[model samples]
Target: MAGEHEHRDVSGGWLRAAVFGATDGLVTNSSLIAGVGGGGGAHHTIVLTGMAGLVAGAFSMATGEYISVTTQNEAIHAEVANEKAALAQDPVGEIAELADTYIARGVSPATAKAFATELAASPKDALHVHVQEELGVDAQKLPGAWTAAISSFLSFSLGALLPLLPYLLGLSSLPVALAVSAIALMAAGALAALLTGRSPIQSGLRQLLLGALAVGATYLIGHLLGAHV
Candidate 1:
């Protein structure tokens, strides 16, 4: 009997949705808070706006992930079913097809022949291997809707809470609010890096700089527009 090997996949629906949702929530909500505050909105009004943005953004992310993952899963299943049917209807032709594919990819004829022979013995496993290794598709991991929904909702909620820090703490100035927003974004990036196994320093610095630039630009614009008015 052949020993089974554990498969390790780096990409999936949950990872994609969680990462994107968190990043978007952090950046978008932070910018929204800063821009609104810079435009001279009251603290309570800013908090309400941020809360609305958070809820709307989370639902939007979840819905979008659901649609995308569902479409991809259907396509992968359809392809696998078609391949299975083809293999069942014509074993010899399927073997030739597999061999030709390997040969086109620079495998030697002898090696391709051996591979084709062994694969023909277990056509379903062979098909799965081809789909995974050759085509980079994972039919088994077709994004659970609940997982995507929860991750997106929670990520956005967590990220959106950052902008509310200054108001919640009763800090009474635009500068203080902006500072809190910057710190929140930086912390979010650090956490993201820790989860994703990247360099915390790099990620934190990137978010910090981006948030600062956004606040500065918006502050300037708001000041100019206020003066003109």
Candidate 2:
């Protein structure tokens, strides 16, 4: 547990979705704005495109996260219910299974059986123990679908605003917008790495590079389209 310090997580749960939504918003909106500007789009058209990307991206992220988390959570809850049923119908078999689990984890056979017996004396305790051992899920920490959806919506919109704010303020310089976006992405990446015990400087640079690539690629494509299409 030396490296297992508590910090914000953003890999495979609500936190992941929220962080993904925000970082994606920043990179995507910045690229869209850069692409439009590169294509010689008028000021109004550029701003409009950035606005469209922000709104569309936020809603899309929120909707996708909602469906994904809800479906997964429903499946897990169904499993928990089935576990409850099994515990109710076959108390002895369930206790044997629980004891087997503990024994497999290095507990002595007699001690494991005793532990299982004590747990089975209370229905709620047995249910909790069985569910965790069988499913590797913590009932108390199950993620909320609604929370993920709302968090994604808000975080994404806020991130997208970082790149779009300059244009809205009548700043026509694309370089300035890009600079702001790069710095924002670096900071976001560094902050995200804090929880995972990664080097913040490396993470920041990686994010900056990726965001730059996205902008560069879109800008070139937009320029080609404007020139030839």
Candidate 3:
């Protein structure tokens, strides 16, 4: 039963944001570095570009995560409030609605009513079921926007630093920088794959390919622009 409940749990608000921030920061900053260097830009320019990307990307990820999570939580809370109000004002009707929902989902009429009736015995349980059914949002494990923001900020900064680190440490060659970036991206992807139950090798290769493509496209465009300028 304990193990079964584990699968039913919904959580990881911060973890999701952090992982996103880290992966995005790595890919985005590496691409910027590759693009600048590949275009025959100065080494200093690439370094500076990487730094700028890191700072801007970290802040952007944090702000975006905060707003997104906050808005979602607000909406869910609002719905929960509405459901609670409905239950308080018209519990019988609420029970009927819950019964209808269960019935629609394939429970027999009498069984559904009985189930709803049992649930409605406790107002809290009734509200919980109603919220889950009507809004499809979890009230017990609500997401925290601040947590998301902090995770994004910290993880994105750390990830973006990976590519920039070698450059900062005086490895100025474009090829070397890109090489490090590829390896880093692959490792990150592989690690992330573990969480998703995917093949690490396949996921790593996929991320490496995508990162390479992005760098190549940006490099081509930057090179063209540099030539004209």
Candidate 4:
């Protein structure tokens, strides 16, 4: 057992939603804060803007994730129903198809036929195999729309809260806000890379750079527009 290891369950849809929502929240709120501060907005205005962005972005991410996951699950369910009908109407042809599939995967023709025939004796087993081979998803493991939605909402709120903390605490310093957000962004990227088995340093730096770019661009635009206005 020393050398044996199990792989992480990366197939769950919640992780994706959480990571995307968090990163979007960090980037979006940070940029909004930078823009408002650069435009010479008062402390109260910046705080209000950050709070609004956090609430709106979290809800948006949750709704989008729920709808997307639900639609995909429905599509998979429809395909499964179709496969079930085919199994009932033409059992023999379905058995032959399963055998052919095994054969294509290098099982001998005789063994494949024998195995497929034996498997067909159980309707549930036959349906499961056919669905996996044809549709490429586990009928028993469909993603939960509520799970993804909740994860997105919570993660986005947490991420968006980081940058606004300084202002909310009455620091009223954009530099302090950006510094805190920068650290959080890099830490988040590193954590994601660690989970997915990638280079944490590379991912962290990439996140930091991209966030800085967005903040910088927004700040510059706000500054220019404020000057003119």
Cα TM-score per model: 0.81, 0.90, 0.92, 0.92
How do the residues 74-162 of candidate 4 rate in per-residue lDDT, one tens digit apiece? 99999999999999999999999999999999999999999999999999999999999998888888889999999999999999999
Error of 4 at 200 (Å): 1.8
lDDT of each: 0.74, 0.87, 0.84, 0.92
Q: Which residue segments of model 3 deviate by more than 4 Å?
A: 1-12
In angstroms, the error of model 4 at 129 is 1.8
Off by over 4 Å in 4: 1-4
lDDT of 3 by residue, 1-229 (tens): 6656334223658767776678898889888887787678887898899999999999999999989988888888888898889898998998888899889989999999999999988988888888888878668888788998999999999888988887798878877777888898898788777557679999889888888888889888888878887
Write the candidate numbers in order of decreasing lDDT: 4, 2, 3, 1
Summed backbone clashes in each candidate are 0, 0, 0, 0
Q: Write the per-residue lDDT of candidate 1 for residues 40-69, one digit (tens) a residue.
A: 778787888778888888888778777776
Tens digits of per-residue lDDT for model 2, 110-168: 99999999999999888888888998877657778888898899889988999988889
lDDT head-to-head 1 vs 2, winner: 2
Q: Point to the candidate with the largest lDDT.
A: 4
**CA error at residue 53 for candidate 2, angstroms:** 0.8
- For candidate 4, give the lDDT of residue 228: 82
Candidate 1 vs candidate 3: the lDDT winner is: 3
